[model samples]
Target: MSSLFTPLTLGSITIPNRIGMSALTRNRSTGTVPNEIMLKYYVQRAKGGAGLIGLNGPNVLGFGIKFRSKAGGKLPTLSMKLEVKFMLSFGIVSLTLIPVFLRPIIMLAAGVPVYAPSAIAAQGGRFRLLPGEPGYVTPTEIADPTPLIAQFKQAAINAKEAGFDGVEFHGANGYLVHQFLDSTSNHRTDQWGGSPENRARFALETLKELIAVWGPDVSLKLSPAGGYNDMGMPLQDTIDTFGYLLREVDNMGLSYVALVRFDEEDDGPRGTAHDVVETFRPFLTKTALFVNSSVTPAEGEELVKSGKAAGVFMGMNWLTHPDVARRIKEGKELDNAPDFKSFYGRGRC
Candidate 1:
């Protein structure tokens, strides 16, 4: 039998199969609320036999209150009255003061302008935002990280209320989380910047908040070698930051760490995703590791059997093959290829 079909446990949650779904954004949201289309899309994957599914965005740069529908459902909209009540129930102060009191720690200090780890801006002309879709802007450097931290905590609350089995913090692909980790991007002199350990601080703190609310089952997705958003850290820095980040995560007793691997010649992580996994797999004393990105089923099974990874995830393939797990188990052929035009919900009938 395929090892992909074997049961596995990630932190407190046990999944029936080793094959799960990766977060892929389907631009089907209406405003910041998930519409009926996304509901059907995920339901189909679950019924087709996905053990788990990760939705994207709620980028912390936007203070967690800002919604980005790049690869996940819109955070369910709760009315202001309900939001305030929810905060009160948790013993938190009124929602209105969240920004005022929870502002980034650095931003509140004297002589510090609000900025990111570095003052670098995100590159443009990559992809156009849809109508009503918020445009991507360069993040301001932060003096006060507390507000962003609170936003992340709120995102955790939103996720729990959304009834997901787990949530993967989108720290990869030049998003806000990755911005803090990249040296070229995070050029601050304070505690949140400089050195591998300092750069990893934001990611670690965010993990703590997530684990506090979501339990230990939270997964952090990372792409250390990623060059998106003009993000490309020195190779050794990438290695050191991720190595330290994994150890911190392992100590936190989190469910797992998901890696976005690339090919041998790919520039995302110095080497291929496989090499990245091999590099950091040893430091993970207690944490499960999940590998994804262009991984074939046979290769995934090998990674599991070899004990390098607990499971494998497929993102793009699952779009056309909802029954991908079953097909891999039976060695059946996959469905037709996904149309590139259909990915953005553009140029389609």
Candidate 2:
């Protein structure tokens, strides 16, 4: 029996297998609310045999970005109720909802300025427009993160009310939390910035808030080596910052920590830690570590068998094959390749 098919305990919930589905933002939500199509999407993955399913929450408190859609909408409570209810009916997987704060150019049109730890602007990319572009704007430095922390706390309450098994904090991929963690994006002289400890304050504080509500059931996703959304720090700075952050998280006794591997082919400054899991594995003493990004089933099994990762989370594989876990366990071939062109936008769901 492959280790990937073995059970793993996460906080109060136990996943039947080590193969889990990572959160893939399918922007199929109706505005900021999750529609029936989105619910059906999650249910299919749960039935396909994912031991753990990570779902992205809709915009929270009108502060997060809505991909290619209008902002200022909250994740409807009813949507969570319905999605959790249907997914739990299968009784085969544990569900976790991710609360993310992403800022894109579209939020500017919604009268919301991009808020971050500093006023730095992200460089242009295929998905992001240049600073001189029509809607591009440098982020507004948040003087006080109290309200933002409150919003995440409320999101946790909402998740518990909706019967989710756990909550995953989106602290990776250059989102609000990631912005605060990286020195390149955060240049504040205040308590929230400057030193590595200060740079990790926002994320640690926010995790405290979530843990207060969900206890040990809360997990975090981080891209320490990621250069996405124009995020990168000096090699030592990356180690000192994320190294400190991971040490603190290890003390919190959370359920798990999912790390996103850096892509060598990506165009941007790379972080010091190229092999994210191997680099930070030493800092995580008690927490179960989950690794993501382009992981294959065979590799995933080896990661578990070798004890480098407690589980493996695959995005594109899960998106393309609903039965990804079973396929990996049985050594069956996967379905057709993912349609990258149709990854976003509606109509596919």
The C-alpha TM-scores of every prediction are 0.78, 0.83
Per-residue error for 239 in candidate 2, Å, reads 0.6
- For candidate 1, write residues 94-156 as lDDT tens digits: 111112222332123443333455555554322233444332444456666678778777877
What lDDT would candidate 1 get against the real structure? 0.63
RMSD of each: 8.9, 7.0
Cα lDDT of model 2 overall? 0.70
- Ten residues in sequence with the least summed lDDT for candidate 1: 84-93
> Which regions in candidate 1 have their CA more than 4 angstroms from the true location?
57-115, 127-138, 263-274, 347-349
| Best model number under TM-score | 2
Output the lDDT of residue 97, model 2: 14
lDDT of 2 by residue, 238-333 (tens): 999999999999999899999999876542455444788889999998999999987877788789899899998888888888778767667788
